[model samples]
Target: MIFIEHILERPNKKPILIDLRHNESETQPIVIFCHGYKGYKDWGAWNLMADAIANAGFCVIKFNFSHNGGTMENPIDFPDLEAFGNNNYTKELEDLHGVVDWVQNEFKHDNHIDVSQISTIGHSRGGGIVLLHASEDSRIKRVITLASVCNFGKRSSTIGDLERWQKDGVKYVRNGRTNQDMPHYFQFYEDFKANEERLHIESAVKRLTIPTLIIHGNKDTSISMDEALNLYEWKPDSKLVIIENADHVFNTKQPWESDDLSPELKTVCEEITHFLKQSEV
Candidate 1:
């Protein structure tokens, strides 16, 4: 069964959560999936993937970032593109951490999930956030990142862009989905600058002693295969799997395809399942 609800966070803002429960006789491990920038829980084949993982004797929670363009009214798509534009790296990291806190405190007793066996799976930019969190928080026993970026500093186009953003008070980027311009204020850059040291993935990955999984598509155009290699290089113990024909997003779409996941996504899910199970040993 699936339990969906709006959970309140630190600032009193509620983020939607999709909890897939397992009815098995024995207690199961917990896996929290974090969606990346421009992504949500209900996107594409995520729900089906969640069910598959849950059926494999695990409880999974998938949620949206409080500021991830999804409002309480309509938690899908960019209805509030302004929020999307104003989103920053620090805020997303905090939101992920907040979810972790909620899982440990609020959902620990009711569900038969093993609080001590908490693991995380992050997609794209969300992977970066998970890496930082897992390194700092000893609670996370396992970590996984799908097509994650190695660095966030070069995401912006130009050098003096930070100054321009501050002077103008708002900077805009084109959203292909809505065909509209989205505004990102100066605060986004300022947040990164404030936490540059904390945001370093290389340092965090090096410190990670827990089982780690890194999956990437060799054909992914958004984040190069080299980035995945870089992640594996930092943590030699990490398991790295690269799908030959898969592109970014794992060949899924907004509207979604048929019941079958693209060959790439299927492999990705299987790899995750195998790694998580092996981590138990």
Candidate 2:
């Protein structure tokens, strides 16, 4: 397996760090993995999941959103809270476009890479980002969302009292594991308002013509199953899979110690691989 990882340098902008995982000797389809809110590429079993997917005969490109509070040096945790505070949906969408652009240029002539077949799988908020990107980007041939949230504006509304958030110019949400108060700058909501139509998930889903797979945990507390149903309903041909007793994170946590994926996540990976493989026909 060829595991090529590096930081994509950008001019006058935040740099993106991406890892390309696959067999260097064979031509392979590509899958880009997007991490959710307060999420990074290497979070939890994501790297393990990326490896598993790559090992199963596909190329997996996983990366961090430029402002996901992770710097190139320390991409694991919330080291740059200011960046996290300023992150918005529009910036994330731009980051996805940048990644796709980089993928196209960097591997334009690589015989081992089948660049024509591009797919995306995003978790939680990242799922929404992937869907929005797929709606507009013709290069994406397939999409698989894990525990995705359907409504971005509505979801951001839950971030502290709107009036207070505006008055203070920021609000804090506690990260249970890190015992840190994650700040959300008012600019996030401002950006949402500035481009609400562009960030709308349902509108984007209804616009997608490619094969789409929507998977959600029945017991997900962060995002409800109704959101998943909404996505399926918006897209006439999309498929929805509800896993029994799985949570928002598919029963897997960060700092995942074991070499093996949780049964639920393993099942999720299986579903993703099978779904992508069907397109080969």
Highest-lDDT candidate = 2
Residues 43-110, model 1: lDDT tens digits: 88887777777877787888888778887667777788777877888787778778778777876786
Residues 69-152 of candidate 2 have per-residue lDDT tens digits of 999889998899999999999999999999999998888898888888899999999999999999989999999999999989
Write down the TM-score of every candidate. 0.93, 0.97
Give, for candidate 1, the lowest lDDT window spanning 10 residues.
14-23
Cα lDDT computed for each candidate against the true fold: 0.82, 0.91
Candidate 2, superposed: residue stretches over 4 Å from native: none
lDDT of model 1, residue 111: 48
Model 1, TM vs. native: 0.93
Residue 20's lDDT within candidate 1 is 53
TM-score, cand. 2 vs. native: 0.97
lDDT score, candidate 1: 0.82
Mark the 10 consecutive residues where model 2 has the least summed lDDT: 153-162
